[model samples]
Target: MVLLRTLRGPAYTRILGIGDYRPARIISNEELCRHIDSTDEWIQDRSGIQQRRQATPDESVVDMGTQAARAAMTYADLTGSDIDAVICATITHPYQTPAAAPMIAERLGTKNAAAFDLSAACAGYCYGVAVADDMVRSGRAEHVLVVGVEKLSDYRDLGDRGTAFIFGDGAGAAVIGPSATPGISATTWGSDGSGSAMISQSVSWTEAQERYAPASLDMPGDPARPDATVTDSLWPFIDMQGPSVFRWAATAVAPLCERALAAAGVTAQDIQVFIPHQANTRIVDTLVKKLRLPDHVVIADDITDMANTSAASIPLATAALLRSGRAHPGDLALQIGFGAGLTWAAQVVQLP
Candidate 1:
C-alpha cells in the first residue's frame, strides 16, 4: 500500500507596488486637428482628451514594458532576479513570433523567468492581475509582475477621426506577492462574444498583405468617407462603434463592480477609490453615478491626458492615483476593466 501525499493550502496574495511609464512626446488635440477634421473643442467635449503621449520612433512595446517593470521592481524593493514570473498584457506587440514578456524579462535581467503575454485588448491588465494573483495564491510563483503596455500610435489611421485622437502609448506594471491577509479578492470576469465585433482591427495582416500585394485585386478607396484615402495599401488599425461600447460599458460594468465588492466582503461606501479602465471621461462619469459611490471615493480619469492606452490604462491610472496622493496604501479600491473581446474583469483590492 502507498501513502497519500498531502496537498499544500492556497496562500493569500496582494499587490506590492505599482509603476508606469509614458512616452516623452505629447500630442495635443491642436496637432491632431492638422490631420483630422475634428477640432479641440469637439474632441474635448466628446472624449475629454486634451492630449496624449506618443512613443518615440525608436520605442517598441518591449522597451516601454521593461521600463515599467523595472520601476515596479524598484518600488517593491526587489530586483529582477527576485521575480519568479512575468505577464505582459498587450495588443500592439509588433511581432507574431517571440512574445513581448520574455523579451521584457530578459531586458530586466530576470533569468529564466516564466514569462508570457496575455491579450484581451483593453481588459488585458485586469485579466493579468487576476492571473498573477491566482498564481501567487496557488504557490506557482512567489512574486509576479503584471504589465499592461501598448503602442497604439503605430496603428492609428491619422485621417480617421474616430480613432486618431483617442489612443496613446504607455506601460504600467504591478508586483504581486504573498500577503498575510486577503489583499486581492476573488475576481469577477466574464465575456460577451456577440459584442466582440464592436471593437476590432480593420483587417488581418495576412488579408491585408494578400489584398495589397502587387498585381492584387482592385482595392479602391471609398469616395464617400473623407479619410478613406488608401487605394492600394491598408493599415490594420483599431476600429470601434463608439456609442455601442459606451452603452455596454455604462450598463454592464457597474454590476460587476458590485459583485467584486461583495466577493471582497466590502461595500461601495467602504471603497476609498474607484479605478475603472480609462477608456473615456463620459464612461467614467456614467459609472460613478450608477455605482453611487460616496462623495469621498476618488475616481480615476487619466483618460483626459493619457487618452486610451488599451490594456495599459487601468494600471497606469492606478499608479497615477497612488503617486499623486489621491489614493494611499491600505485604502480599499475597486478596479474594473472592459474592452475588446467584449471582455470584462473587476476586483476589490487593498492598495499597496
Candidate 2:
C-alpha cells in the first residue's frame, strides 16, 4: 500500500474531436402510426421525436460504431497509432463474449491501443470519459477514444407505447486527451439501485415461471434461501417508467449540474453551454426553466430529429453545436448524463 499525496485537483481532459452516426432508414411517426395507435403530435409533444433512424436488419452494431469512430479520429486529426486507449460504451454491441471496444480497435486498426467497454446504461459515455481521463492523468494512457454507441431498436417492443416511442438508434464518439487547462473539469456521479425497476426488465421472472414452478421458485429471498436477490431482470431490454423518470431527472439533474460547476469553481452564469442527457425534451426544458440558466447557456435542441440516443445524446448535441458554429474554442461546456444506474453523472468541460 502506498501513502497518497494531496488529491490531484482538476486533472486535464480535452475533447479533441467528436462525431455522431444515425443510420439511413428514417422511420416516421406516421410509420409508427400505421403500426400503433400514436399520433405525430402526441409523440412530438411527449418525447420531441418526430422521426428516428432505424438500422437495416443487416447492419451490424460494430459497423455503426466503426463509422462514428473513424469520423471522430479524422476530426481529431489523429491516426489510429496516436490513440493510447479506446473506451467503448455500448449496451447493444451484438455479442456477449468479446467486448466491442477491442473489435472497434481492430476495425480502426488501433493495434497498440488498450480497450474496454463500460455498460453504465445511458450514463456509460460520461463514465467512460471519467475512466479515460484517469488513465491519461495517472500516466497510464495518453490519448483515448470514448465512444457511446447503441442500437436500442433491436430490443424495443414496438407494441409497447411506453418503451417504443421513447428510444431510437444511433452512435457518437469523442476523442479525449490531456491538457493543462482541461476541456473537461470536475464530474459528479450517483446511482440508486432502488430505482432499478423504473428502467429495466426482469429476465429471471420468466425463467422462474417457465423452468421452475411452485415450491421450487427461484425467488432469491425465500426464507429457505438466504441468498435470494433483492431485485430481478436487469437484463433483456430497458423498461422505463417515463413520467417517474422525467420527474426524477428534472428533480435530480440541476443539483448535480450545480455540484459539478461548484466542483469546477464555476457558476451557471460562467457556463457557455449545457449538453444534458437527451432523456426527454420535457425534462431538459423543465430543468432549464428551473435552473434559470441563460438562453445562450443551455441547449435543449435536437430531440425532434433524433429522440434520446441514450449514451450518445450529449456527444451528438455537441457535434451539432460545433457544426452549426454555435460554439467555439474557449467556450465552457457543461454536460450531464443520467439514467438506468438509476444514476446521474455531471461534468463541466471547457471546449477547444
Best by lDDT: 1
- Who wins the TM-score comparison? 1
TM-score of each: 0.92, 0.87
Off by over 4 Å in 1: 1-10, 209-235
lDDT of 1 by residue, 211-286 (tens): 5544334433322223343322334678888889889888988888888889888999999999999988998898
Global Cα lDDT for candidate 2:
0.76
Cα-based lDDT at residue 343, candidate 2: 73
Off by over 4 Å in 2: 1-11, 202-235
Q: Tell me the lDDT of model 1 at 158.
A: 69
TM-score of 1: 0.92
Q: Candidate 1 clashing pairs?
A: none
The lDDT for every candidate, in the order shown, is 0.87, 0.76
Q: In angstroms, give how far residue 116 of model 2 lies from its true place.
A: 0.8
